[model samples]
Target: MNIINRAASILLLLVFFLAFFQNSVHGRPLLLSMSRPKPDDAALFARWLVSQSSWGVLNTIASDMGGAPFGNVVSFSDGLPDKGHGIPYFYLTTLDPTARNALKDQRSSFTISEYAIGTCGKKDPENPSCAKITLVGKLKVVTEDPKETTFAQTALFTKHPEMEGWPKSHDFQIYKLEIEEIFMINWFGGPKPLTVDQYLQAKMDSHTVIA
Candidate 1:
């Protein structure tokens, strides 16, 4: 019995470690071995964080809940793999409170952490060096412009293939955050003072492996 128990314990530990490292190894599409940017490159770091991550907590003002802030786990994409454009695009439906809330009030914010991308190994999510970003902006639907809608659809579908098969009756539409302010923490001191223009303008190095 003691031998069996020890073997079981060892198996569990092996599974845990594999699960932890697998994200870095296979979670991303093309980025199999991309190293994170230095803490000082605020814009590149922020863009990298957004591009590498596939989902995040999107916060909106819930009108039905007495104007309270509500955060929902949502899937989003900036672009395909290493081609991210820095603006997060989402596929949402009114059946969900998040889309309903956005329709009533466009004010919103989206937050993503480096921990999700698997680079912040062994560090608590809240640890100062773990790196996190919150994009403050107005969430708006993108059906008005045919060009933008096409881009959104391609970007979202490429990253999240399952979305293509999502129930159409739910009326999922493309929505994007028009980032106005950027707040990021990659190192210790405090939130990195990043501007929307800076973030959008920041260019990823061709050599940088991001996917």
Candidate 2:
């Protein structure tokens, strides 16, 4: 073959090999990959924890709370949707004692976990897959204001439709949690858990990037 033709042929082969290698490393077909969990799952789990039980061990500061951290099951509802983000919102009744204490302190953490058993029906505390996610975030009490209350209630009802008929007799107070961090472990075992920023950014970029 002519020199120019030979060089062109080699260049094409190099390009082809490079493309193949890249795809092999990172490309995954939709059918073969795991789909992301829907936002609803997080929302549902958060609401379920609150509605079914007001009891959750609260993680709090020691010196602030009489020099030893405290864990207590407190009744709570989902707060407000995160600013510019649609997240599970929760509300704490103003009349609740725990809510009052949290309001006074203004710093706390809350956790919600699912129940699962090992193959032998034994409770495995070390199971990563069964490990519950505990959200550590800054908390603030939402005092009564008709507009804020309306917005929060609307979001809560939308997420938890079953609570629609519940009597409005309770004086619902709003509490907004700014999620600073989240801890989750993979019980199935794989890579490390993703940071909230990393997870959200990946979702955003994946949707925007061209194939």
The positional error of residue 27 in candidate 2, measured at the CA in angstroms, is 43
The digit string of per-residue lDDT tens for model 2 on 112-149 reads: 55331112135465655544556676666555677766
Going through the candidates in the order shown, the clash numbers are 0, 11
Q: What residue pairs are clashing in model 1?
A: none
Those runs of model 2 whose alpha carbons end farther than 4 Å from true positions after fitting are 1-58, 61-67, 74-86, 116-126, 143-151, 159-170, 188-193, 199-211
lDDT of 1 by residue, 73-145 (tens): 9999998776788999999999999999999999999999887777788999999999999999999999788
- Best by the lDDT measure: 1
Give candidate 2's TM-score: 0.49
lDDT values, one for every candidate:
0.88, 0.48
**Cα shift from native, residue 91, model 1 (Å):** 0.3
